[model samples]
Target: ALALYVNHRVRVPGTADIVYWLADEWDGKGIFLQDADALVYPYENLKKVCEHINEKLPFVERIAVYATAADVLRRTPEELAELKRLKLGIIYMGLESGDNEVLKRVRKGITAEEMIRAGKMMKNAGIRSSVMVILGLGGSELSERHARETIRVLNEMDPDYVGALTLLFTEGTPIADDYKNGRFHPISEFESLKELLSMVEGSDFTDCFFSSMHASNYLPLRGRLPAEKERMIRQLKTVIEKADQTLLRPESYRRL
Candidate 1:
């Protein structure tokens, strides 16, 4: 099981104290330090927190967090190795879309090449990397390019885990405003599923676990790559061909 640590107090009072607080309040095998750029937190400070968790709560097996390509790039090889040694087992990064235009539109601030380097760096340092891609981030206009290029980049990164999430707009966000003012048009649910199909069909990985099991997705799929690749692809194809809405999650149930 996993415990979430997202309070702003985690930043002010320090991560180690928060770990102590969590240890008192919750019991779990893993802790998901939920921050937008958790790795950007000072290396020494993070290392200390990891050390405290391992020492104070020996049952916690993994420490995972959300990170960005820029955050990963800022870390030196030695620092990453040190963090891995301290039980920073995995990192979850958002590689929202692999298409350059989409990346620019979203202002991700890092190129696909840089993202590949970050993923490889984590792998070499013995830290598992889990990356996420948004299914309909390009809206209807660049849907195919988004899917195909994402597959290409994922192939290059070959992360330990790949999570496929469908696009959703939060209120007052620029993308949400764009949708309101006719500047953007999101693909339909089935179209998003089609994009997912393309990703599953095109992805090539050594031993990664690929999944579209996020709550935002219409369908849930998970399997080990290359080994279960064909079976997963066939499953997606059949779902798409059937076009059965009842087989998919209802829109009301989906959330960010």
Candidate 2:
């Protein structure tokens, strides 16, 4: 993929690093920003970098900046005003499983209260945000909280987009280690689908774009919420109930 993606005709230096790209500074030394989420960058700094780049050759047809796990650590709600000051239009976040216990077990480094504050901060900043969740992070140990608390978080922030990614244990991470050592156990494929469906079963955010279509998920699904969510949930459930272990998402999908 790397060889194929490198275009000789293209002179762009940086492949894809939001921090560098924001500054019109793209170096090839791209480190996959993976520390739960990218919510840590200060909005003021982000906005300054973004505004500077757009001044010359605008790289955006439509402006959309994501701050995944905004509710986790990257930044706090108080810093959202900086985004508007810089004229940013979009913010994306991953509330990746609302269960507090699950978050603790995974060592995500943040709490439910902080997550709520972070989301509200994004909304107040006038930067539209997308909130995501992991369907199977809790597994059997936290099944009840997994479904209940997720809804609780969603109810609070009610982001512009609510997405879901079924948990996929990547290589050598703490979560993966837990899985190997029996310290952590995620839901079975079928149960995961159930958790996903149940978490958003009666969600009030009708306008949020819901996507479970990423490569990491068992079911690649997408739709608007409140209305189609039920049908979408049921459809996913059907697949999980029917398919065997072979139906699981390919482990290779997780690289980081």
Candidate 3:
């Protein structure tokens, strides 16, 4: 809240929130719940915070959330309505990929079926949801399946948004370790882009928001719905089919 005030960005009003009782590292000790996934406070404490914000910064419009574990919220349809009544706006969830192979290889710890359930449930609660997909997560062995299964899950979830992110072996991670030992082979930027488009083509989602405009992405593409989605995918594919690999983004710049 203070940061938003300081930034003078009244753009999207509501604040983001999180609840993770299961990851409460402080739960075992005398200390009740500790912040792990994010700050987890008592339900009463949360109500107080919302009340305080409403009383003071009434302009605050929406409350965005990214709760990894939906169990903690224990939110029913009525409860979600209560949250909206309290000015909670949008909720984002990561359906990383529908491919179980890619998910486990990345230690995502969430199954495709579970993601499908969670995402659809979130939409049912009137909370806007976001799903993320990673290209090249399955290496060459499962790349095609990764794209195919990912689309399968997306159709099942049909989130309001789908974020397509590239995979990279960042230094100091388990992925990096695998890279050094030749256990993993990183895909080129071009193939990653193709894989992203494939994920979309194989899927039958209609209005999902698409974005890869992050700095790390080789090409930052974003759009909404059928037209914009096709346009963005075509634009990216053109870049890949035409651009020379030797002359493409240099290693100093590309991450994934």
**CA lDDT scores, all candidates in order:** 0.87, 0.66, 0.66
**What is the number of backbone collisions in each predicted candidate, taken in the order shown?**
0, 3, 3
RMSD of 1: 5.4
TM-score of 2: 0.72
Q: Give lDDT tens digits, candidate 1, residues 1-256.
A: 1123432223443446746566557655687776567888998898888888777656778889888888889999999999888788999999999999999988888888889999999999999999999999999999999999999999998999999999989999989999999999999999998999899889889899998888999999999998998899889888889999998999987884
For 1-256, candidate 2 gives per-residue lDDT tens digits of 2222232223345656453334445333222233443345555655566566455325332345545453334554455565455455666666777777888887776777778877777777777777778887887788777878987888787777777877776799988998899987777767777777776575777377778777767667788886687778778777866777666666666332
Better structure of 1 and 2 per TM-score: 1
> Per-residue lDDT of 160-191 in model 3, one digit per residue for the tens?
78887777667889888988999988777787
lDDT of 1 at 71: 87
Give the worst 10-residue stretch by lDDT in candidate 3. Answer: 25-34
What are the candidates' C-alpha RMSDs? 5.4, 6.7, 9.2
TM-score of each: 0.86, 0.72, 0.76
Query: Candidate 1's error at 237, in angstroms?
Result: 1.0
Q: Once model 2 is optimally superposed onto the true structure by TM-score, how far is the C-alpha of residue 48 displaced, in angstroms? A: 2.6
Location of the lowest summed lDDT over 10 successive residues in candidate 2: 1-10
Best by TM-score: 1
- TM-score winner, 1 or 3: 1
